[model samples]
Each structure stands twice: as C-alpha cells, then as structure tokens.
Target: MSNVISAKNLTLAYDNGRKEIIKNASFNIKKGDFVFITGPSGSGKSTLLKSLYGQLKPKEGNLVVGGRDLANIGSRQLQELRTHMGIIFQDYKLINEWTVAKNVVLPLMIAGYSLDVQETQAHRLLKHVKLSEHADKYPLELSGGEQQRVGVARALAKNPVVILADEPTGNLDDYSSNVIWDLMENACQQLETTVLVVTHKIPTIFSLPYRHFIIESKGVYEVH
Candidate 1:
C-alpha cells in the first residue's frame, strides 16, 4: 500500500521556545489505513496530528504527508497540502449561530462547491450521522452526542483524503462513543477514507482492523 504520511527522525517543538515534544520520531501511515494513537496527557500525540495537518512544523528530519515534505513547503504549499485533510476536534466546534446543516456544509462552502452539491452532500452526511431530522437546528440545540455527530458529518464534508480525530470520544457516553466509532469504521471500511485518531487509550475489543501507536520516552511506536 502507498503511504500517505511518513516520518523519520522528526523533531516537533513549540515555536516560542523550540522546546521539543516529540524527538527522533518515525512512522508511516498508509493510504486507506485506520490508526489510533494513545498516550498520557502530555505525550505529544496531538502534536503529531498537528504535524500531519501542517499546523506543526518539524525542526529536524523528514516529515511527509501525501506527496509534500513539510520541511520544504511554504505557506501556500502547506495550505494546498491541507486541502486533502479533515480534522475532528474533541469538542464539537460547530458554530452555534449556524443551523446544523449549515455548519456541516462549512468545508464544502470553503472549497467553493455549488450550493446544490453542498445541500445534497450535507444531507447525505447528516443521514449517515443520523442527524437528518435535526438539520435545521443550531449546534446549541443538540445534546453533546448529537453535536459530536454533527462534527463527524462536517469532517467528512469534503471527502478528505484522511481524517484526523483528537479524542473524539473522550467526552461522550458509551452509547455515543460506540456510535462515533461505528461511523469512523464505516468511513474506513465503506468509504475507504484513511483515519487517525488520538486518544488516551485503545479499547480491548474491536471488530474492525486498525493499527495502534503509542507515545513514550518522547517517541512514537507502533504498539499493535
């Protein structure tokens, strides 16, 4: 399989102080693969995901996403690279003022997709998230689980090449967590979208196939 993300001896750090968070880290995530990252609170899992999305710049070694090397890209090139990625936050970051449908269509709108296509795709995604009936409501009108479902719908809006999720189930109940996992599984199994989720731990039981990475000693390793 072709790799979508490849890292070797990468160093990630904070911009202000150049304080390293992840050092000499190396890994590869293949296209259409489903992967999970887990570690303690300050383990730099989020930092790694930020690097995938170009939000963090590596200070050393090679870090490549899709076909672009992060160390070689300018702002324009970095933005272009990010066009193929989608992100789901731990908190549902939907705009409270916009209707659920409108919020879900934000990415498509940004990409200049036609209104007709936006509506059709948004409805389809909403249906998949089981929120078609709540499309007309605002984010604040939904429960935590429903709001997260809207977040899922929004993340898949552009048919992104990969989806990066950060603690997507951290705040949800078991029922909602299962719903979110099922949606993610379907995205990988049926839609063939690559997925990388950062969480505190991996579950003991899962029916779908996925790789597990863990951060320790300031490096990342494939644990399963």
Candidate 2:
C-alpha cells in the first residue's frame, strides 16, 4: 500500500509545562487504508488526530502527509495541502444560524468556488449523506446524528485524499454509528482515500474492516 501519511519519532504536548501527550510516536497510514486508533482516555488519540490535520504541530520529529513534510511546509502550502484533507470532530461543527445547505457549502466558499457550483455540489453531497430533504433546515432542527451526517457530507465536498475523524461516533446510537461507519467505508473505497478514525467505542473492535492501532506507553503500535 502507498503511504499517505507518515510519522517518524513524532512528539506532541500542551504548553502546560508538564506531561507530553504523544511521545516519539512513529507510524504510517497507507493510501486507501482504513485504520482505527484506539486507547483509553488521555492516551493522546485526539492530539494525534490534530497533528495529522495540521492543527497541532509536533514538538519533536518529522511528520509527513501526501508527500509534503508537515514540519517544514509554509502556511500557504499547508493550506493547500489541507485542502486535500478532511477532518471531523466529535462535535458537529455546523453553523447553527445557517441552513444545512449553507453549512455544507462553506468549505467550497472558502476555497473560492462559484455560488452556483457550490449549491449544486452541496445538494449532491447532502443527498449522499441522506440529508437532502433537510437542506433548507437549520442545525437546531436536526438530531445529533443527523448533524454528524451533514458533517461527513461537507468533509467530502472537496474530494479530499485523507480523512481524520476523532470520536466520530461517540454520541450516536448503534444504528446511527453503523450508518456513519458504512458511509466512511464506502467513501474510502470509492475515492481511494485513507481514513484514520479515533474512538473508544468497544463495538468498533469488531465493527469494521480496519487495521487497529493502539496507543499506549507513549507509543503507537499495530495490534494483533
């Protein structure tokens, strides 16, 4: 498999002036691979996800994604690279005041796409996520799971090559979680995109066809 993201002796920590979250972690995510990052709370799952999306720069070693060394990329280059990556968090980061269609089209707007094209693309993705009927509705009108489904649709709007999801199914019921997982799996297969999802949900251990990586003892390793 081709590697889409690679980390070598990568380290991350908060400025609390105390303990580091991820310590000398090294791993590679191959293109089109669906990998799960699992561990106990505070084991650095979220921190690691953040680093992959360029939110938190590693305090220590080299980190590369899509053939670009993240540690050395300029802000403009980072922005361009990030355009090819999608990130989803536990919370559905939707604009409450905007319609669902508007929320899903925001990324395209930021990327300077035309208004008509953005609307068409947003509607198509909303249909893909099974939320087409709710396009004119507000975030407050949707359930938590529905909001997340919209998030997933928006994440795919730019045809990203890699997707990093942190606790994506944390608050959903079994059916909703399964739906989200299936959608992600399909997206990866159809687009040849690499997916790294972080979650503590036990059911995930047997839920999907993913290579599991456990974060423990300040290191990351593929589990048997």
Model 1 C-alpha lDDT per residue in residues 25-100, reported as the tens digit of each score:
9899998899999999998999999888988788899998988999888999887777678789899888999999
Error of 1 at 58 (Å): 0.7
Candidates in order have lDDT scores of 0.89, 0.86
In the range 1-224, model 2's lDDT, one tens digit per residue, is 77898999998888852668888888888888888899999899898888787888888899999998877888998898888887777898888999999988877988999999998998899989999899999999999999999889878888889988999999898888887888888888889889889999645434446788999977898886
- Model 2 gets an lDDT of 0.86
Model 1 regions lying over 4 Å from their true place: 15-17
Return the lDDT, model 2, position 96: 93
- Model 1 RMSD in Å is 1.3
Compute the lDDT of residue 113 as modeled in candidate 2: 98
